[model samples]
Target: MGEKSEIRMTNDKKRIVIIGGGFAGVQCAGTLSRGLARDQAEVVLFNDENHLVFSPLLAEVVGSSLSPLDVVVPLRQLLPDVLCRTETVRTIDLAASEIEYESDDGEIQRLGYHHLVIACGSVTNLNVVPGMADHAFPLKTVGDAVALRSHIMAQMERAEVCPHPERRRWLLTFIVVGGGFSGAEAAGEINDLVRSSARYFKNFHREDVRVTLIHSREQILPEISPDLRDFAGKKMEKAGVSLVLNARVASATPEGVGLQGGQFIHGGTIVCTVGSAPSPVVGRLAAPTEKGRLLTEPDMRLRDSKNVWAIGDCALIVNAHDGQPSPTTGQFAERQGTQCAQNIIRVLQGQATRPFSFSKLGELCSIGGHSAVADLFGFHLSGFFAWFVWRGVYLFKLPSWAHRFQVGFDWAWLLLFPRDLAHVRARPTDRVSHAHYQPGDFIIRQNDPPLNFYVIEQGEVEVVRSSPRDQNGEVIAVLGPGSFFGEKALLSNEPRVASVRARTPVEVLVMGKNVFTQISSTLTPLRDALAQALNRRRVDVWKDEPQAYELLKRTPLKELMEPVPQPLLKPTAALAEVGHAFVEHGNEFFYVSSDGQTLDGVVTITDLLRARAAGAAAQTPTNQFMTANPVALAADDDCAVASNVIRECRLKALPVVERKDTRKLVGCIRVRRLLAYVFKHAVIGAPDSCQARNQLAGGAGRGMDWNNPAS
Candidate 1:
């Protein structure tokens, strides 16, 4: 009998989990798989969809120049050696180092991991204009492109046969909201399709069909120079697509769009191609955001949570050169993904991880046919030169040689064949109601066979463990929105640890076992993150201090109230001066603190109104009615505390003061100012706040807030 030599196991083998199959995720997985040796690591791609969508060519797909399948490569063939699974990851357990997902078969599963990579891309940002979700078409997913194509073809056909001229106009009119690269490209492509297709339809008048591009800004493709944007605008206008500038779509209906200028353009189909942000998952993480984008550190790591890393559209990684996060373009996203992969490897290998750096190599947009606009390495070109460069760059970036070959072949074949119009219907999984769930519903019964891990969508649920002496358990923990349950069972393939019942009508997603396992196996830190989240819920003592106002050092000034537009006085002694200031100047108040450093209380014209109402003299010190306390806060105090103090005292115009020696006021934040700040600046500025700085300073804390809309 001979003993077999012991097999050697090294740290070379690593498991990486990727959540999306978009350009970023696909590129990361493809690069990692091919770059590493067989024994080095394992790359597992977990996606809700089975194919990788070539996002840059999506407009072509919609234009009938290319088919949807032509742009989508099957994940299995794209990365042959890497593991590919179609599952919806529902929860990330960071503390326990695992992830949970719902498989197509409706079973919950979990996967443990050694490393994690989040390449989840952005989704279309709807819910902006009224009736947009119900009526507008978005061009993000493959299905969306196909549906828009079908709708366009069908509308052309319908317009030709219609007897009424108004109906025909409505049917032929196409309005695209936004003038960004996507919008301009989509408008141009659709215009080209209509120009070509109308030749075949007899009853439709090509002139009757109107194509309009509406933008809220003065220029399109802000990524390019103003001169280039003007050039693009001129090209679009020459092609018969009207450019509506400095106007936004206020609302959308099946019939048309209502512009901010009150101009109504009737249309059969409306397309929105505005840029997007991180997935809704970012919101749940409770971190700062920049315009709905998750803020990341210079190293492309999330602000607070370490051990966690986010890339692509999900992260607002600052550009070292411009002090701005890289744009959400396919090129930047792919670069970020690759950089993220490199960082991941370095982190796992105990090597120094490098921060993300951005270089503006190029920007391109296809106008129509072979005509395009491009800016490469500070070199700008148009027409054939730009188009050819666009093709070459994208071809080189394709995930695999097989995919590149397929795409190239398709491009060549398309010249000889008309585009195929076959529709592929991928049924949606209905494991959970996105909108509603009632109380007493057993989300997952204890002792029952565990199927799917539940991702809370809305409302609340209760995780109850039977008391040691009782046969049935009473309510124990109330899980609110964004909290997940059934994670243990999903990750370990083990029996249910507790009974989860809905405390209110709750909405949740059920993730199957295989998918959960796949996600867990790839994103190791997620397992620990999720467990820490649960533990945080369990140990939270905030509930005990419901009425307690915790003093925060960085109070958000935007959360405080601002004064309405009242007239400003010239600091005169006359009552007429103050009254005239309120009505004539319309400044709303005196700018007592124009300088950034030495600001005091502002005397608004509205104070006159209150004084008159109380039958008090306007000259009565002008300080008595100043509301002495005025809810003061330090300039560096937590912004959160400002809002709490305002709410608690029911006051407006909180003073942001310096507490060191002078205790002098710096600025007065009015309720209105606060509200506007929250509505506007919070979407952009908070991503660069102290909270983000503190979190990114150090620690394996979770990355960006997975649930914040700003993220």
Candidate 2:
């Protein structure tokens, strides 16, 4: 409505606007165009894509039996009399009888309609499982099918060149979650394609390729009879497909799927066809919804709205024939579309609308290798003959003869030749992404090439390094949310120094090497923070030494800290008073407080010099030059923690308090004194001094200057 163009009605004729181009929307538009005169109404259809994807054949696309375009029909060609629009519908205003859509150039446009049909089907949603959205392949769209096909070919290519047998086995494995029609068909096709194609590759063996289908139910194909379901399952297993029944998926990760009872299935490729949610536009409507689907009356009209109609997968419509909610399938949607059109015509003709009724035809599912199962009318069929019937029915179901002919030719060609193995080699682009890991999963291995920098978002990970004393790696640090890792190896352009494994189920924001380097180098604050963390982690080597670890743990801050050198001053004390006190006590800094007991602020010699350089008078309040709420340590903290804090904050010394809550001034720990203590007791003077002293003194000398005051 804001600066948007309004589509004016031609000759003041009625306009019918449909919001999707799926089976329902297309059939409704076609019926309306044929039933109404040109002068009576104008039919306008809106869809995000120009073509309608035949979802039933998507698995064949992934198996490379059909070209990606073979299963799609152009909407404009299918509905010549209807005005087809590819603009994305943004909002529906039922009160105004208008809908807003974004044009190709990103300009908003509005069109008023006498009638509105809601038919936008549901969308694929993988968020039901923890990591499924990030790691699994969805089979809901044409693009999804093509992307999965390319990934399958890429994995096979990688396996051919892999030197290790275990790694190659992982690469050749594929897992499909959900035992529905899509999942079962995909698993069957994947097994057939990989096994049949293995004969051509010199390094591949049929036995090494594994295709697993995981279903949570006792048997698959619940839409058909139990006999057909059993036949389909047995046929798939006989064709070399592993079926895991009665198992529920707890989460999905880069490694594989994790089951509810702590079973982890490891595979290289994972396909998910389980979850779905209503379209965003439909979900936003102000109407009663059941399980995210818009509720509609028996006549296919939206509840309490005469001019608005709802149909397809986005709507929950009760079928008069079955006395139950209609299933979300192509057959049901097409029938609903036809009946809804008749109801709309009846309303215009001043006649009462009829309730929608339809008897379901049948259910058919292909199990690859020229075998399928079918339940049609009262008859059930399976095996090669059933596969032929399934193909015959869907071939004629194509929108036009041209499409049917093309698909039929492709099917004939597939019978004579092997499936296509050629794929476009697209270079992967570096970007930031998210990843999930289950407990005990290795996120990164020691000595592996660093490819991603990780920032923890949830759960915890352990940084593990190999040790001479134990075969299992030692956990040097446990990192939780807000912590980051992998930057050390990336910044140094070397292999990982330590392996990172998930201590609990974890999620992390991962940035590729190039993206991480570019952002960190350009952002000064981020760069400085990473450098500080690197310096703090560099001292972890001392923790692995038994004597050094014991010494650090035994010594407390109260024992290592020196007494406060100068008397504390009030907050309102003059700068001249602070300078005189510093010179008298021969200290570089002094604390300032209102009562001299509670720690408030600190003023250093650097603060006084800067104030003087700025032409500040000696009468200026010291509070103006003091740092408020400075970093302080508790008296009970150990020397190891103190050393790490000093190195991280890059401070000469830090104030120590008796207790954090009391804020009573106790003493201060100096960097020089801590370093001397560590060298004398833990490294150079210790009984196990040779290795510890050489490693620390030699490797740490390049960055540390012992005599420098600020070190």
Q: Which candidate is the best by TM-score?
A: 2
Model 2, residue 612: displacement in angstroms? 28
Regions more than 4 Å wrong, model 2: 1-5, 10-12, 427-431, 445-451, 464-478, 488-499, 512-518, 530-711
Candidate 2 lDDT over 535-645, as tens digits, reads 656544443454554565568889889986568888888988888888788878888778877777788898899999999899999888887656567687676556544
Candidate lDDT scores, in order, read: 0.65, 0.83
| Per-candidate TM-score against the hidden true structure | 0.57, 0.76
lDDT of 1 by residue, 560-609 (tens): 52432333222333555556555666654553332333333356556667
Angstrom error at residue 144, model 2:
1.2
List the candidate 1 regions with Cα displacement exceeding 4 Å: 1-13, 35-40, 275-277, 286-288, 409-711
